[model samples]
Target: MSDLPPNHHADLRHSGPSGYISGLTMIVGRGNDARLVADLADLQPGDHVLDIGCGPGTAVRNAARAGIRVTGIDPSEPMLREARLLTRLRRPAGEVEWAQAGVEDLPLPDASVRVCWSLASVHHWPDLEAGLTEVRRVMTAGGVFLALERRSPVGATGTASHGWTADQAAAFAHMLTEHGFVSTDVSNHDMGRRKVVVVTGRT
Candidate 1:
């Protein structure tokens, strides 16, 4: 549906009971992506990680298990509620907190996070530049930044167009650099039955 650029699904939002249920069920398949990003963070005990656009807190819980503190921020209260319920059912080794907010505005202090990541969620950001600025502001100098998105074909349409194409991924990497991130890279990987593209950088 869209090409070359990022955040094609900027207008997409998850709210209400139905949206929360869908996030917990349909989008819950992002477990593989969660693990991929958690491993990418390469965090140590007591490090602070920030998860943007966290849904159902899958990646949040996964990373927190590494004995680090994590803040999972989302725009939907209902989704945060679901995340809290699931987290309570199965606790992680590290501390975990949740906030209801969008990428454009994070509820965090400056240079407070060691690693910041978003899994299969960056494309939904309403304002990619503002989101990246917020991410950079929250991350410490030399902090890792990563984003994972399913690989969508260049001309794909409908649901098949939800993810990033190679060019789009590269574009996002460029944006990261523009936002003062260093060593930005764009790479491809596989996640379960899906192919994914990952953009990485350091703030």
Candidate 2:
């Protein structure tokens, strides 16, 4: 989720081909990002993890492989469908569940998840503050949360429409602190060809 609803840019209905294309792109190009998130999460066996806006369940699959139970949520039906198919194919040791839900409206109960990650999805949230509030509400005490997004280049076309600016990233980190997340940090990293803004914190 970015600054706008996903449907505003791309409608990913299950009957359409765009969702599949997006899923394939994630499978091939976003492996490193997912792995990075998994490593940061340091998931343990039996731990429950949530992947918000889990496009094709790439991160969910990666974390599940580490023996963590995973729940992937997305607003797109096609994306969720693709995620289930991919997870079934991978067959990770831990259980994996997929749900069609937006970041601001999670289906899980409060304090249920031990860890949560949202990659390239924050900007699409209709209400950033509300979404973060929801995130905090669902996470257990001392739970870890990470959010990552591409840092769009300056003067790049559609930059505003795509990713978060440096200042926005900083503000997001501050928001985490205000929401009672400790050890919060916001930094930029060179992720191969592009830079990314990362926000990490613990409840």
Candidate 3:
């Protein structure tokens, strides 16, 4: 059996319209992960950024605070609702756009984003290849894709149902390379029980 924790959004029937809120709150309550993305993306003000699988707009709000034009996309309308609610809480500093969509079929123009990041949401993708392909298509040349995916064998259990295997990372790197991304770095970073691989690609 898979060792990953149950997805909070597994049942949307009773999840209400703010399912994204629960998921986002669970994934990123404060701004810790946003700081991680900031450090990885080295973002500057006015940069157009995309936060794929952006739960509750944590990264979106954080990026917006830095004067970055942030757009968040997710498949859950409930999540988007929470993101909208979260956006309402921002102090009208920067701009934030929200889209109810997924990485594989994003509602964004091609080669239009400066930074694209996904935190702790890669494993839920039904088609990682298609999702990454869409990511590549929407990123401008030299744009950054910081995908922090959970890796297997993170804890004493020696198995992670929620995390991807080492081979999976290599395959993702290869796919990114095939899609015209260069300088791909795929390695695991220990995050307590989760080993996240920060994949950066230059297109």
> Candidate 3 regions off by >4 Å?
1-21, 24-30, 154-160, 191-195
**Order of models, best lDDT first:** 1, 2, 3
Q: After superposition, how far is residue 177 of candidate 1 from its true place, in Å?
A: 0.8
Q: Can you write out model 1's per-residue Cα lDDT over 1-203, one digit (the tens) per residue?
A: 34547898888888887677767673457778888877777877778989998888998888877778999998988888889988999899999999999999999999999899988789889998899989999999879999999899889889888899888898899999899997898888876688998899987
Worst 10 residues of 2 by lDDT: 4-13
The lDDT leader among the candidates is: 1
Model 1 residue runs over 4 Å out of place are: 1-4
Which candidate's TM-score is highest? 1
Instruction: TM-score for candidate 2, please give it.
Output: 0.87
Winner on TM-score (1 vs 2): 1
Clashing pairs in 3: 20-78, 20-79
Lowest lDDT block of 10, candidate 1: 19-28
lDDT of each: 0.86, 0.79, 0.71
Cα lDDT of model 3 by residue, 1-203, tens digit: 33333231222321464574466555443366677777888897667999988877788888888777988988877777777886786654778898888778989899999899987677666666688789988999878988776666423242244555566566666767887788788766665554566667777
Order of all candidates by TM-score, from best down to worst? 1, 2, 3
TM-score of 3: 0.81
